[model samples]
Target: MSQDSTVVCVVCGGPAGEPVYASDRECSITSLCEVVPSPTVVRFCQACGHVQTTEMPGIEAYYDTQYKILIESEEEDQLYAMSNGQKVYRLDHQARTLLRKLTPSAAARILDYGSAKGGTLKRLLAERGDLRVHLFDVSAMYLPFWKAFLDEGRWATYRPPAAWRGTFDIITSFFSLEHVARPREMMAEIASLLKPGGTFYGIVPNTFTNIADFVVIDHVNHFSAASLAFLLRASGFGNIDIDEHAHTSAFVVTATAAVQQGTVAGIPRSEIARLGSEVERIAAYWRNFSSCVREFEDGRTGRPAAIYGSGFYGTFIASCLSRPLDIRCFVDQNPFRQGRRLLDRPIIAPEALPEEIGTVYVGLNPVLARAEIAKVACWSGRRLDHFLP
Candidate 1:
């Protein structure tokens, strides 16, 4: 597979870099049965050490309907579910830290870009009642959530009047940039929307540190610390502060819009080499992972099996395996998805997982997956397998 020369590095406008992975199989954010196949190719940009794919086709159309369906498929009250193991539960802690570093201001106009279901904004408003909060997302499916919980005057669906330009004191994009086709353009637009000296705080997957992010089909851009800094600076941002330790496998950055165009720095030679090595390492890991999954599936051929966690990790496993596993059901904790069918397999809640299921693949982030599995009372004596390290 070859890189499209016309599509340059999103951060530096340099040449399309190196190909890291290509798959002819379907690559959809949703499950295999629900989506049509769109072949995927991921590349590594040496210019700024960013990893991205060729711009996806019909991205707007896909996000409008398919993405909205994905949101609706989840529990309606999931945003408020602050359970320890839930995905967005940590957003409360993360938001508190990011907001504290902000310069104290009265009635600050804060916008949460890509605020799906308005969860972060809800948490923010609770912490800072004085903030004039706003919400924007591609889909309006969460409008009811906004109407019920947020200030009526604050929310819009990516349509603000011309007068609203450069009016915001702070803008945040959490786990949204990776899904965008043109990250540079997205950053520039956000810069234009902010007041002079306005801060932009973003959180994206730290691919340099997390291998799992590499295969996430929905995430087009895999940003490292260096890549994110370069993209922010090129988009007229300065006084940048990036924290890789504040969150696991994510880069939390705080940048202010500069009065003039910000300077762009080159990626270090050592850093470039390291990124290349990491790319190879991840590719190797995927090959090994596929082989391991196949072997495990073969060993348990006659027995009924199920996968835990129907989110990204489990969905990726369902989508990528070459040989079909005898997966009878998908075990998930989210109530909305419990009765849905994914990959032609019924999605059941943990309590619904039958005793006939001899083995359960723990398809979740390895760090806390074991503890999460232990919490399920019914799976106490069943065999558990780990697919991720």
Candidate 2:
């Protein structure tokens, strides 16, 4: 991004719209990995209603080293893992949903791009035994799982551009495109990877649907429904359909590669402005959130406190707390993280929390924060304003 030239939208080659938020790069919530400190800049494009960061560093390194830590730990990272068995349920349900919409062929080639741990592909394989499934991901640490999950010679790491041109009937990416800085090029690559008239199904966070997604630093692309439609259409895709009901923060999309060039739908100015306003509103909410955290810590420095939800938000709260020793532990429901420690504090189950614990800051996503706190039987009817607000 040169000062002389305007930044272009990642989805559409439109003028970089408006700056919505600026701050230091936050810690990775998905992988719980440390990131190099840099100024974070989030902008929204008025032409396409796509929100993106202007500063995107080497993402490959982020995934290979920092992101791979979660894989090596055998916990699969919070990014891939879901709460309350929802990971399996979500994957199986999405696979079944997609299979229901498509006319399955006797021998269909399906590629799960960014197939972390090959879990999604595994479910798809079990459900559609006749399909030829393949996996692709940035982190090759999951390579070992492929042999057991898929047939031999079905997994791949980084490949040259268009290496498998026109080879698959379906190419799917779940929560992958938003991490890429060059989304337009990614769309083009997706188009090239699929056979003519092949379906490209993807799921990405809808920032408006879940405001917490708007704050995640790693998600460079904050796509609205309109922008996603534009991206697919601009990438020579047709018949784009979005299912917003699949996940709270996700948009499940199905599109087909066009045989020839086609026109794309442009977002209305009013809609783009509305999306930009949403960016502003989320930024304000976070500002108030940070302030509330600071106010709580100002005089209650010696209280025994813990953070609920050991994912990104919890990690972020821990980073903000001045008296780290006051933070006794982290409360998480993930069985894999129960006995583990994060940021030098033990991650305990809700039942394991000490009765003397003064405050338990809810670090879960905003959408689930209230409900998660309500589940703690020990804290029932307790004054939890300091913990949740």
Candidate 3:
């Protein structure tokens, strides 16, 4: 392209510097990345807050290959194991919560932009009998999950045929925003896909993720809330909002993007103490498990007393434990996960519990912890004392 037809920021049309690898883009019409080195590009719209991206040549083919290679039906086991692993579960919770916030009644028509296997859409539409959903994704495999939903009359799926730009009540993309080259244009596409004054829902990680996670893991850009909102406005979307877990806020967002100002924002902290306090609130609400964890010296053995429950709580607590109170083993119900090593310690199933471990810390959820303790004590035939009381 000539200098007269030169690229600008998609959102605000600012003079884009020629950064080596730019994520922001200028034009929504063209594919977003280009290889640049010397000037260092920063294409952003001043008025609309839109971001422009620089694309690498052949990026399109790469993304296509990634989608097919990843979501292929043949790799079901690998996908299932990784996709449903511990980390994804927590992230999924945020996605579900966002869907709920965006469309409360379930009576509206909804579309999940990158509907992988349609699991999230499936979960969102499960309760509301009035919901009608459509699935859109690059991979053809996602068709069946939505097909099942359609066949069950749970949702009606539609593939945007050539030149088919229909309006909808709501549109959503969970963890899929960073993958697009022209985020501004993609935002425009989303708006065009929605009816006038329609709602848009999205969830993106904070701009803290590494770029390698981008190149190798299907992400092209990492966006901050301010940048994202600016991009949306440039796309002709009037109301734009974005948020995420801040401070100790682990992984995931509690709500989706609502109409512009109505969207959630992460709790902001003005100072160090305030930030610490906010994180403490997050820990109390989401991360913390033990109300009070206390350890005592085992006078005779001197071999530090141990606790039970090998989940996140136990893992964290054990790591924080001091010299004399070092943990020896962990107990859990899931046989596959049990007998595993956590923090270099054995996570044994309760059946392996032995006598003389005497006092045990029940770090699991209270109700479930009690039941597990009962099973462990009964099955092991060991008179294990619990710390709950």
Number of the top lDDT candidate? 2
The clash count of every prediction, one per candidate, is 0, 1, 24
- Give Cα-based local distance difference scores for all models: 0.73, 0.74, 0.48
Residue 49 Cα positional deviation in candidate 3, in Å, after optimal superposition: 7.7
Model 3 poorest 10 in a row by lDDT:
26-35
Question: Following a full C-alpha superposition, what root-mean-square deviation does model 3 have from the true structure?
Answer: 12.8
Most TM-score-accurate candidate: 2
> TM-score of the candidate numbered 2?
0.89
Residue-level lDDT of model 1, residues 1-389, one tens digit each, is 66555667776778766577876455544322244466656788887888886556777876665665335522343222325655454557667767776663888998888877767667777887888888888877778878877766777885655666899999998788988888888898889889999999888878666666776666788887788888888899999899988777788899998558836778898998888788878767765665676666666545667888776667766665555456789987867678988778899988888777776777776566777777887766666554443
**Cα-based lDDT at residue 221, candidate 3:** 51
lDDT of prediction 3: 0.48
What are the per-residue Cα lDDT tens digits for candidate 3 across 106-204?
A: 477777776666666666666565777777765554555567666543333333543335556777776677667767667767777776677777766
Cα RMSD (angstroms) for every candidate in the order listed: 3.3, 3.1, 12.8
Report the C-alpha lDDT of model 2 over 1-389, residue by residue, as the tens digit: 22423778888887775566765334333434343455556787778888886644776787765565345543243433345636444555666767776776877988888777766667777777888998888777777777766776687887623557889899989778888888888888878888999999898988776766665667888888888988888889988899898655689899998557767767888887787777788877765766677778885636588899777678877766667678889988777678988888899987788877877788876776787677667777565445664
Per-residue lDDT value at 211 in model 2:
69
TM-score of model 3 (CA atoms): 0.49
| Off by more than 4 A, model 1 | 3-6, 24-35, 73-91, 150-153, 321-325, 334-340, 366-378, 383-389
Worst 10 residues of 2 by lDDT: 24-33
